[model samples]
Target chain A: MKQTQALNLQQKTIKALGVNTSDAKVSLSYLSVAFLTLLIGGILGLVQGLERAGLMELPPWINYYQVLTAHGILLLLVFSTTFTIGYQYANLSHALGGLLPKVRKFAWTGFILMVIGVVLAVTMVVLNEASVLYTFYPPLAAHPVFYIGLVFVVLGIFACCIGVFINYRHWRKNHPGQTTPLLAFFAMGVFVLWFFASIGVTVEVLTLIPWSMGIVETTNVMVGRTLFWWFGHSLVNIWYLVATSAWYVIVPKIIGGRHFNEKLIRLVVILLVILNIPGGFHHQIIDPGISESIKFLHVFMSLSIAVPSLMTAFAMFAVLERAGRRKGGKGLLGWIGKLPWGDVRFLAPMIAMIAFIPGGAGGIVNTSNQMNQVIHNTLWVVGHFHVTVGMSVVMTFFGICYWLIPYLAKRKLTPQMNRLGVIQTIIWTVGMILMAGSQHLAGLLGDPRRTSYTTYGDHPTALSWVPYEYVMGIGATLLLLGVIIQVYAVINMMFFAPKGKTAFPVSEPEDGAPSAPMWTERWGLWVVLLLMVVAMAYVVPIVDMIVNAPPGSPPIRTW
Target chain B: MKQFLYGLVLYLFLLLPPVAALLESIMIIHMHMQMPLLILSGFLMARLIQLKFPDFFRKWNSNGVPGIMLFSIILVYWMIPRTMDEALTIEASELFKFISLPFLAGVPLRDSWKKISSAGKNSVFIIFIILFSLMGWLYIAADEQICNNYLRVDQITLGWGYVTMAVCMAIYVIQLIFGDHSEYK
Candidate 1:
């Protein structure tokens, strides 16, 4: 009878979230698309780097801004979102015990829409019809289709988020009184935050559609800009949350650590949900019409949101210490040596965290009302985000993909592939250090971001930036190499590798499940608080703006 | 369906340059009309879209984050003085205000907030309180015209309005904090 029961459990586990093979296919498709896009984005990055170095002559068809925009859109938005969604879906479904109703459909629909949207947007971008850069600030208008395609992509994400929500609800129903699985909790937190945060972009996109299509004769450059930042800042948090989720749930287990305090982790996620949305106001510190007092308040709120990140930092290190010490290592710092330095999964996120220290610190300066004036549009700001989003989040995603692709493909990671993964992480980390370091240095010298470097026709002072740009260009080349390796490795694992099951490792807490207050799972309260925080940050300032009107600017294309 | 179309029509009417400028010429209507209408129109569009794509709506926004966030953005955008200035002066800007508000802000929010938790509602209140207070302080402190169209006195009055609303919000928050007496067993 015991044997029979064990067999039954194995059968259920094989199905893993009742959705069956179709779910795996959906996940794989997303992963594939993500990597494919990464390949193209990586090549663009290489070209941009070389172009900055003055190493290559530009093709007649390929403009700097156009390539830059494609690079940003594809890698930053497309690659990150698709990879995160795919990985999270697989994890959430497995943890939740099955796919909930309509999830398969949602995933497929989202994927298809995303693909179509990417095609529309990228085509126009390649044609140089939309060269407004990824931030796409207007009076720099893109082709109408660019905005429209973005709308579809956002809607696609919306659909996927819905599926996750449904699965969460279903899981709750099925397991009354049980603690929500940590992975699912993390995924849900990200989805929830993203749902609200995306509104900024949605508004921007909707407004752009009519303006670009000539339905609206003029656009309010300031409003469009403000809306972009609103969306823009939230998008950063979304990336952070994605990477953090992996840290909270996956990293501990992989490092042989028991779960960091689960309730504390939950609370951290909750705090992030509420606090992350309004922090976007900090980005507008240099922008006009917003009051000094409000900007100051945003500064405070921005600092407030940093609390969770701080908490996460503590929680992560504490988990590492516990796991390290438990493996018969002595002394306060001695356990560091005991960690799995070999596995790419551990090394990648660890590297990401190390990068985040400076990245996060730079963020505080970026948010500082007075200090922000110094670096508002400088390459220092560029370095800050690249370190934060580029190093931290992108690296974390790469870490997840190492094991995740193999698992989804029903294959064991070959030793060669594992070795390649480790090399990729190291190369990427080293490259980023070189790239971001130089950017920060150059930015301090008053070098602006988003401009192609040319030695001709500049003040003598401007010549200082050339050396740093050269370093950055070199860094970009190395990073491109890592990107190529990562793409190649993932493709091999997905298709050419041998088939077998890999563990979906989730660590258990050190002292078993500590009784967490049920309120830890109370998403309602958190959501409400989040909404309130967002409203307070945005409402009055926006209202004040509308009450007093300025002459609106018409859209103008520089290209 | 009727409501959706009506909302759209109303939205378009508000976008007309003369009508929009006339509304925006006043300090109160300009902020209240242009900003809230963006949300209202968005809410309406969300509702209409839901009728056609119930599955998508139910699956995605049933929890209210998407709708609430969308509405919040529109509300926030028009509140910026620059947005208002442009809407009043630029025909295209005014047109966008009309379409975006009702469709993006109004439509989605109407559906979303319904299923949202009371906690969510309370949070929205808190946001308003903080926003109003800051806005009030800024308006009151300003010696010069912040918006080109509005008088200095109007800015002061708006400041007062914000201060008053903020006070009310603070009181309400205090009340909720003191009033709720649920015991965990």
Candidate 2:
């Protein structure tokens, strides 16, 4: 009994002292890399957009494809991965009281490995040795060094995953019969998805290494494409899962409300983990070699993700409505008006959540068998991801920075900084609407993606897309401005904001809410289920691709 | 009652010609997916039966040994490639498969599971693991098609499916051995 009280007191002291300095340093370093990548990637995006709009010309040394490749890799892969790690690690440390010593070492090892990997990859891109774009789909082969660098990135991710698993297991052992803190649970979900999602891409990259080196005469293009999507699609959800973690836990506290039912949250996490990897097939809907029946089954698998997403939408509204009503707001729609609209911490993710309604609908269009053929290689697909990833996921990450950076740096978010964040959020939302909305319209009008500026002798249909392209260029410029302000806000909060303690806003469960079930903690079972689902989804089509082999293709350089 | 209704709905859905044809068209799906789903439906439906005839279960399978034995025999009978071929070709065998797998195998397995000792449960997993490994090896290494209904490539796919299933079961057993469940529970 005395030991229990002492332990509780010790934990309270740790919480009062704020995030541990060593842990804060690790998270802050990762955040710095993430924002730095965003700055560079944002610049590249502006260049590409203006060039695509026929407003700018690239010099002989630099090309549009190289800029596009770097933009995709830096923003999509590096920025998201680094920010998730930094933010999730901070959550783990704050929630678990502190990370295990070896876990901290593992985190540093991962950071170093990832940094080295990124440097190698970006150098290859800059030197024009590899401009295969982010997907790296063969017969457009990259330098063997680029693929090897990707191997390093996957290995680095594995290091972080192992660290999280070890820490989770240690906590479970120490606290018998007690559920982990909600944020720590979210951390576990994020890393579990990360570990599994990377497997398919790792396999693809390993094969490409041999093929790219001419060690193998040719590679199976269909298998390569299939494997890439398996990883590619899951990467989308990893970001979604990370964003939803903030929505479910952090946002509620920011709005002064208890979180929704704990069981539903855990269930959403589990469902997302299990149903995620197979959804990658929808990305390959128009790709050949897979039979129609298998594609039909895959369509079902892909749509299964909507179930959890809808559940999340329902839960978020419930939390907001309840919180608003408690503050004396009346009537059915009046609660919407009562939310913290002025707070950047709430406003950014609030708009992010709103963006997902359209974003998710666009996804369904892409997943459909017929609709995919209509916009297969069009900018509509590009527009879909930009809204989904750019607004829905990245904006949430932006909101998190408002509080997260300050908490990690032991600083207060001054009102001026908060006001700047609100402005940045507004600019970002407006920019994305103009950019992604026009991209969708142009895509429907037959504009292709990943292609340099071409007028096709001033063809009428081709000329029709020019106006949308210009709007995209203008929107891209606005977005770059937003990115600059965001980076500034992050830096200001991290180093220059007034020094004081800030709370990590993990919310409590509502009064009378039942505890999450013990079965939800059985991660081993969840993993086995995940493996079984993957096996079921992949075995048929993959086997057919291998057994009925076509003549494989040698490397081709399109540029 | 809810379980029974869910089971009935699943069973009826599986009975649909298009659904069954689509699932059975792929050899691995026929065995691994369709067969397991049939068993799941029966497992769920068994709750109603257990409630309806508690005395029947108590008297015939008091220790769960008899029920488990019945399940093992029926499951083994279905795993034979010749049996799968026969069910596709001969309508009588098909009827027997539909009847025997659910009523004899799945229902009895569900009743037997909780009543069995932990060691007995482990033994069941061990048996399946060995069976799956042998099946995987036989199907993968065979020169000729193992089943007349399935193409050689389909047989190979089923072989890989068996191999993956065995790997999954092995992982489960290993975790069961090493994991200290009391820590979390």
Candidate 3:
């Protein structure tokens, strides 16, 4: 035991903390839940895809809206959140030299809460008690149980967030005055964004409960919606930050490259924390009651969030190019082919980044006040998020899982699984090309989203959407098939594969910078600044909303 | 026994909402006010029951996992919008709510939470978080009225209430996690 302890200390700080076994279990549990959700969500996606193609008819009991809601909730919320927490737990423990035991307990609690919440909420959706789409905008009511279940989900995540903070604090005390590890810094950014961004939903929900319970006769639609968007926009940023973390930290290592300048990365993360929340105004650019000036200001703020992303692109490419050159690759762009294309880890994130180019560009278009009018609520917007969240975030997560499962399960990655992983990435990329591409094209043609175009009855405009919907249907089917293979590979690797340990690749920083800026670690200053930015973005409009608001609208049930 | 008195207090606390027409009259009040009170009361009642019948509590909830699971199950049942709606519209449902909150959910949770592993607590935390968000989505997204007494829009607004509570609870959990660490040192 003493010898092992000595060796652990010599190896890395994370192992010294002696929580890997438990951390592995914790992470695996979370990953399992995420994968489970993905499986269910993937099947749902295929069903919807087929439905869109007009090939398979959905029964009356399970309508398009119900399928759509399940698809969104399971994939976007359940899958992503569970995957993130699991990833965070695994990486954070290793990076930070191990978490406090107490923190780990909190993580477990959060996981249980999340599972129960998902089951309850999804049950309602399945039973048709809550046919409300994932957004759950007001004036639409579902079962109160659905709302309560959702509350548990949020709280469950909240508990996990708490675990993160606790562990962070414990680490800070143990290594006072030292800089936190790169991945931990990234995780911090995610949680901070989550905690801050959640305020929007919090405000929206608080108001909603009273109104739903009939405490109030009417609901102020503008207020509730504004608040929802506030949370909504930030939530996307949180997902972006997760993908960004992998891009900044893991991608470099996976490509045999060194880390980017740690100081700059930290600054970027901090900037994201402050800037991510205020950008919600971009989602509300076209909403009434908010002044045009305020909207324009938000437009600018929203544009600013892109700066870090741009920085990331520059930094990532530099790292990759450097790694390629070190491997004796010849020219500028030639280095790209030199990287490990066959490895699922490199391929998935790479394709995701490529997808982001268009996704990010689309975002810029969405942010522009006048331009948004052309494609707002269109298929284009749907395409944009799928590219960003679906392709970028979800794809990276899958790549992480490829390695993570083997590591956590203490199993070797079989040749079959490795081959499957590579194929999954390729299939995903191709599927997204067909799916998101057609969606973007259809969106540009003023095709509406979230509608069964084939069932348009006699609407002449529906003709334009039919072709794209068919293409999307084909793409979605391919994508879901890829998901099935991916899931199978993961399960096989975790349970059925031969036993062995895998290496966790953590790279060193390439930039030989002396010391990180002190201000980077000054969380207080950054938080204050974040609040300031938020106030600048929201204070005027909210005040105006309160002072000159119209009469509250009574609830209306369309269905 | 002092334990029984505590249980009595829990029962009284839970009964307050329905007796006063608080649970039935307002949608948010019923969900936010009455439901949580029920859980809290049940939590206290569990403690009392544990004290009064240590053997039974020990056998059922010594490790806390089983008891907590039971608590979670009961809580999940009560949280359904249908259950809440029924409680308001039907007399028997209200009585059940009163009984379930304190005796079934609250008491067991109180007993289980103490014995549950930290991992278990973490799971509990996540469950509540997801529940809150799910509720938020349901209330906000549903176009039709889930509750007879409430308008469809009001239901949507109520969804926001769950969202807000969940967020606040999350923030608090973070504080608790960090707060305990500092104190431990």
Candidate 4:
């Protein structure tokens, strides 16, 4: 105990005042929920993996799509959405002088509502009373409560945007002259984009709830589809934004250089936000009700957005290369050798980026107007995003959180935290690769994407994809173990990382390159709100086509 | 007479998808309006989203704000078909049905915008994607409406979706070959 105290004493800094921010309270809470959500997602992932192979009898978790669905919704929608936002909020609060009341309250409320919504959604699905999974694409409807729960979840998401807006306002107000933290700017841009992005869905949900509840007898199907796709397609964009912000802020710092082309990054954010809304008609590829011209337009737009991504990739790597050479790395490629491999910040994101090859492949297949027949709703698609979003975004998020927690808490994390990072990252990498790979193969074998029953004890034909499914099961198991290890590390740090570490006051960053508030109060508010109007404007016509398509008119095919 | 016959056959091919995918879409949308339609459309749109949402000609936005907007739009659009009513005139709908033209910038993968922007590295791959879309249009304009309708979804070609996917993959491959941010370059 005495020795522990001495080590603990070494970690504390009493003379310097800690930064004043709400990051601690809010981030910790968000992590608590997200951590649980991650573990649950991992467990269900394991079950889904095994079940895909028809290996339920070998493990209780097989035959668990209900569990898997619950996991995806919670992790993808509830956890990733809020956890990353919480981190952004905390970082912004510190970057600015203090928190905004409107934003803070709204964020907290959103967190609680998200928790409640998750409970409602997971509970109903767990009972097998409702197993629609993360997507509520109608004809395969779940209980009304499931839809209601999701709407509440969306409300929580809206609240998070409000918080993001406030953070932006706080940044601008406190540091009038400073450029927004690249991360903060990116965060604000995405949040603002989301604020507008969410409106279409809000309209859909507002319209859907009453109609879904049977309030209107002849509700327009066109309106619902137009609105839903507008929101649905953009949500993936939100994930991209988060991933980009992580890359810009975290990746550069790890490589030991400040961002060079900040303006382009900012422009990328803006272009991505605005351009995303006009291109949502991609989902209607196979549908006959809408115009082919619209599909063509969306397809072109879909392909067009790849420009900024390539630009960012090139710019970021250029900086990274410079950083490597500056650090005395030899030869053209010797800089790669000098990079910090063990560092979570350096290693995790690299893995995430590498995994995207298949991810991109899956995206192209799914988004193409014609190629959908070869692999629509297949396991291949599921595997694709798991690599792109889950590994690239979620894993990098974990890395960022691990890197930032010590700074936020104003103390060193247990060295064990570093060890856990290595372990979890490896697990995430291997597990994701295996799991995603298996799912792709399974989809090829015609294994259904959201089925509740794929695990039979005696029959292999019923589970045609059983051979491929086992690989996924094993992947899930590894992820579960990895997440559990991480949770324990968090617990140990929160509760038992010696004394005096927990209560240490927060401190502003001392990089001394002229620090300023993270965001502008007015800009984020105006931008997101303005975009919301645009979202509605953009979505209205699409909906109109669906609702008023002259019924039974055979779409006037002149060919 | 020859031109009219050719146009008539093309129109017939185009009409099948709008009828099938549209009816399915309608079933999904109508069901949300109440339970009766839900039974049919729920089964149908689920099939479509799984079967169709990833169409290469479809739009994408798996990036930041665009992604959020794109995702939310899907949920919102699915709720009220009437929201779309104001956007389309009866004549426009007929014109849409009569002539098999691409929608939303001429491809199904408009959603790729968000993804490209979000991925931060997929940008270089976009150039190839544009070329692919152009080539697809050229091919369609020339001839080959055969499997086009078999892949014909509602009014869109299922084959088009596959081609668009191929384009995206091709770009990805090109990026993989040349666009590595690694110091190895």
Q: How close is every model to the real structure, measured as TM-score?
A: 0.76, 0.98, 0.74, 0.66
Q: Order the numbered candidates by TM-score, best leading.
A: 2, 1, 3, 4
lDDT of each: 0.81, 0.92, 0.78, 0.59
Reference-based TM-score, model 3: 0.74
Which model scores highest in lDDT? 2
List model 2 lDDT by residue over A130-249, tens digit each: 999999999898888898889888888999999999989888877888888889998999999889889999999999999999999899899999999899999999999999999999
Off by over 4 Å in 1: A1-20, B1-185
Better of 2 and 3 by DockQ: 2
Tell how far residue A71 is off in model 1, in angstroms: 0.7
Displacement of residue A401 (Cα, Å) in model 2 is 0.3
Write model 4 residue lDDT over A1-559, tens digit each, in one string: 5633542343242223343445467777787787777777766666665555656633453235566667778777777777777667765664454456677788889888887877887777876656555655443445657767777888888888878766665444444355766666777777767776777777765655554456543445565566777777777777777777767766767766566565566667777776676456666677766566556656776665677767777876776777788789889799987777777766887777666556666777777887866667777777777788878777777776665555555556656677778888998788887888888878777666766444556567546676677777788777778778767765665555643332222222223534333222234224443443343234324433643555421111110
TM-score of chain B of 3: 0.85
Which digits, one per residue and each the tens of the lDDT, describe model 1 over residues A1-559? Answer: 5644553574496666333466678889999999999999989988987787677768887789899899999988999889888988988867866565488788888898899889999999989999988889888888999988999898898888888888787666545567788889989998988787788889989988888888888777767777787878888888898899889889998988787888899889899888887788887898888778778878998899789899999999898988889897798789999999999989999999988999999999999988889888888998898899889999998988878888878887888888899999999988999998998988888888887757658778788788888898899999999989998998898888898777787788777567667767766556666765766676657656655647666667898
lDDT of 3 by residue, A433-506 (tens): 89989999988988877765364675767776788888998899889888888889888988999988776767
Report the C-alpha displacement of residue A369, candidate 4, in angstroms: 2.1
Best by DockQ: 2
- Model 4: number of clashes? 173
* RMSD over all Cα atoms, model 2: 1.6
Q: In TM-score terms, which candidate is top?
A: 2
lDDT of 2 at A159: 97
User: How many clashes in each candidate?
Assistant: 37, 0, 75, 173
